[model samples]
Target: MTNSPKPRARGADKRRRLMAAAAQVLHRQGVERTTIADIAQAADVPVGNVYYYFKTKDELVQAALAEHAGGLAEFTGELDKLPDPLDRLKAMVGAWVGQRETAARYGCPTGSLAVELDKRDDGGLDLEVGKVIRLLLDWVERQFRELGLPDPDDLAITFVGAYQGMSLLANALRDPEIMTREGNRLTRWLDDLPSAREDGG
Candidate 1:
């Protein structure tokens, strides 16, 4: 007599499914353009059932934001297993380059969402949207700091900005090579940066 999965476990799985589908749909279609019914369809959950997990579209959007944040944390944790700061940072850029086609099509999962949310007349949602970008920026800043950079924060902002800026152009131009080219340039730049200790900072 095997025990069946608990109701709580089933509920959690359904909630996670909703959030994952919401993230993909939101990334492909800006927040304003996406609806709870669309997410319900994508998740394969009944439209009425969606409200049991997410009462409003905004709630679902928040869940998607949390999903992105969790994914970023997990990805950075994997990179942290690499010993050298430079290696980790370069690997980060490599991953981005690997996703050039997707970025060219979707304009970056985090960056596109951030841009769209930031422009919203509803001020509340925009405030929460920065969490995704801040996570990446803070992670990059930590890597730079570990490399003994004198201005890790500034370097982190510039590094992340370069990726976001190029992602925009790549999507607008429908050119994946834009990301490949800029990612390579950023990789080379990362390799060439001098450590603060070397400069006696």
Candidate 2:
């Protein structure tokens, strides 16, 4: 019985490694261009081992989606710990701007992935890729609502749109500084908000 547990534990470890590999490969090569072989090589597992865990590439994609979702939740969870709603919102913005270098290279993992998946028209998989953006939108909306904004949803949409646009520009220009500048501009705009002033009081 103890020996049986060893195999299960190893299987779980392998699966975790495979999931991490999938996310890395997907980000570097994109979903359409990435092959199971790439993922296996990244994970340092034999190519045949990929089939042992995942029956199809779509299944592996789902695994990667789960990883992204977990990352989104963890990010928001850290922000949720902050007492001030505006501070939480700023922190969220800062995170993207802080990773301006990475965005320049990879172009916002969730946004780029969504665009690629949507271009393929892979049935409902686009929705899966969209969940990350939706999570961000929902979090931003919640922060605005906590600040008692009348149009919290609209504010959320505006902020997310600007962030994504800045990311696109940063990636296209190969300049992280552009993203940082845009983030600072967003901070100034947030500060000048009438609702924010009222909420601060």
Candidate 3:
């Protein structure tokens, strides 16, 4: 099948724009409030073209969720560069706090999406949301494992749970400083965790 020259050149670009726009709109506006038209306008694409790419709004939402999942995977990989696993864990927490203003204004992107999707009771969307959450949990757990923590899984849960709880409060209070303070506290806590070998090795 011969793809039209113009469509061929821009197909990838348009889809990329649409997916990026979908994630932005979904994060800022919530999935229920976000519409395909909203994403099209954000992407500056013709409304009809959205249908060509995504059969329905739900499909677009899934794509947007996938984009987030991909980002988390990439982020975790980058954090691996730090020599110390504990440092890696702190860096991850610092990143969340680094986006203080943005998170305060819009809330945690993946966290908010999970809440919106959960409220809708849509079929199987919870799995998509869970995947995003799991990505962070798993990465943090890996770092804990490296530190030789006896209960890396439970320790990972503590780190992520504190992060998300801080995110929620920061959003509610619209105070980026709250996250910064909590993030600093987390870094200190990580520093204080017994050496993995010392703890249980």
Q: Which of the numbered candidates is closest to the native, going by highest lDDT?
A: 1
For model 2, residues 1-201, the per-residue Cα lDDT tens digits are 354558878888889999999987898788879999999999888889889999898888889888888888998999889999999988988998988998888787778888888877457778887887898899899988888877899999999999999999998899899998999999998887777556574
Q: What is the C-alpha lDDT of each candidate?
A: 0.90, 0.87, 0.88
Report how far off residue 30 is in candidate 2 (Å): 1.1
Give the true-structure RMSD of model 2.
2.4
- Residue range 109-183, candidate 3, lDDT tens digits: 888888878887556886788898998898888888888877989998899888888898999999999899999
Query: What's the true lDDT of residue 3 in model 3?
Result: 64
Estimate the lDDT of model 3: 0.88
lDDT of 3 at 193: 83
Q: What is candidate 1's lDDT per residue for 2-56, written digit by digit as tens?
A: 9999999988988999999999999988898999999999998999999898889
C-alpha root-mean-square deviation, each candidate: 1.5, 2.4, 3.0
Where does candidate 3 have its weakest 10-residue lDDT segment?
192-201
Off by over 4 Å in 3: 1-6, 198-200
